[model samples]
Target: MSPSKPTSRQFEMQLEIAAPRGAVWSAISSDTELRRWFAPDAKVVPRVGGEILWRWGDLHAWPQVIEIWEPGSRLRTRYDSSIVDGEGGKLPLFLDFFLEGEGGRTTLRLVHSGFGPEATFDEEYDGISRGWPVELRSLRLYLERHAGLDRRLAWCTTTIDLAPAEAWERLTGEEGLAAGSALDALTEGDPFRFTTPAGDVFEGLALCCESRAFSGVATSHGDGFLRIAVEKCGGEHQVWLWLAAYGPAGPGLDELEARWSTMLERLFSASGSMSAGV
Candidate 1:
């Protein structure tokens, strides 16, 4: 019985945060800090070989074991199928976090490795590939701006019979989001302004933008964050919209849920007659 190691395929991401390394380290290691930005709830054991548990509602994001734990430099975790996924046939996965910089700025790099290059591995690989960028944006948001504040999440989702890119157009297009700039002209880190059909105005830097996902900060909404992604679950493409507001002074959560839930339903559901849930 040895430690699990990563296989061939892996993904990496790096971002600069305007926070001290110790603060960045704490945000990734402390359970309470993780809850503020990463997941809805979290639990962490402090030492090497300790557990790092992340939960969204009743579902586990992915339970993992700490492999390396350095104070302000690096932290690595291993994700074994047996203890975490509760399935067979997949290799163990690893998440490595590296921090660099001095003073009030730090560069954080993430490596998620150990994905088998088989067709069966697509779901896990694709999901992680799409998810981490969004999560890390939240991390930077917390450390740089909203440290120590609690977060409230407003989520809405539905499924459509369209491709991810097309769904994105509908999400950011005229009849859809009516953003300040068209999807074709948008790039990551660029400023974006959009008024949702329900009158939610988001004017923030684009955090994540791809064929399948979009996330950004809403400076107008108490610096709230909005993440829109399309995931392929089963036979249909699932549309997920998450709005994160730290502390207070943002829009009403219950009202946002209702408005965006109905917005998504009216936009994507009518064409596909999809199931709507929040």
Candidate 2:
């Protein structure tokens, strides 16, 4: 006889919103409204077997393959995180949210299942416990203040250094390679625009710059800071840049950091090579 399969465990959370079922459903169902609270960047195809893409910054926040979509009732999906890790595979788990109407009030029940035998139910449960409160709070505030959708906000920064002479070359080098190339391709004079792998773009602008130093702030997605400076620390032609981003604080911070770090690394390498020849 084959071994009996282990029973799957599930966790759930419930919330009561002082809103009509239709209002609550619209908040979760519409992609634009969903981005206001759940993610700063997201695209949703609300249908069975459709896909939902969520991004927090310059990274893949999380992608969910829709399993069920019942307008004004329930939404079910399978979470997939494989875009970040090559070895990542789909886990035996799924999530569902059921929205029900109750005489001028809306009740939302979130359920997670398929936690296998070795699952850390408590750990997973605890993490989401805190997360939901903050997210939901934002949702409530958004609905009350904006009638349902919150304004999008985001910020980004870039800082680096090079020898004064080399810096000048790149800042004013070949006709098409001056200030245009000094900054990231996504950057334009004054305002800088960055597009994530998932196709979500953020807009900002240069706020400051000087000899061997540059800084900027962008407004639209949120508040972002960027700085670039050059100094001979330990005499090795060091260039340092710092970018601190702030937005809705979604599920893509780690991935955004990784992608930005790689981009900066490449920028530094190329700048260094040019500096060497100066």
**TM agreement with the true structure for every prediction:** 0.83, 0.48
**Which candidate has the highest lDDT of all?**
1
What lDDT does the true structure give each of the candidates?
0.78, 0.54
lDDT tens string, model 2, 1-278? 99987665666777777777777777876788776656667788988989887775542266778898898899888874222223565554587889987666788888877664443444444435434544554454445434543453322222335555565344323321133444433322466654444344445666444445554553533444444444332224444333434335333545554554454455555555322100
* TM-score result, candidate 1: 0.83
Root-mean-square deviation (CA) per prediction: 5.0, 15.0
lDDT of 1 by residue, 28-129 (tens): 999998988887789999899999998765323678999999989999999764223445554588999999999999999999988776667777788788
- Top candidate when judged by TM-score against the true structure: 1
Model 1, stretches more than 4 Å misplaced?
1-7, 58-60, 81-89, 173-175, 233-236, 268-278
Evaluate residue 108 in candidate 2 and report its C-alpha lDDT on the 0 to 100 scale: 80
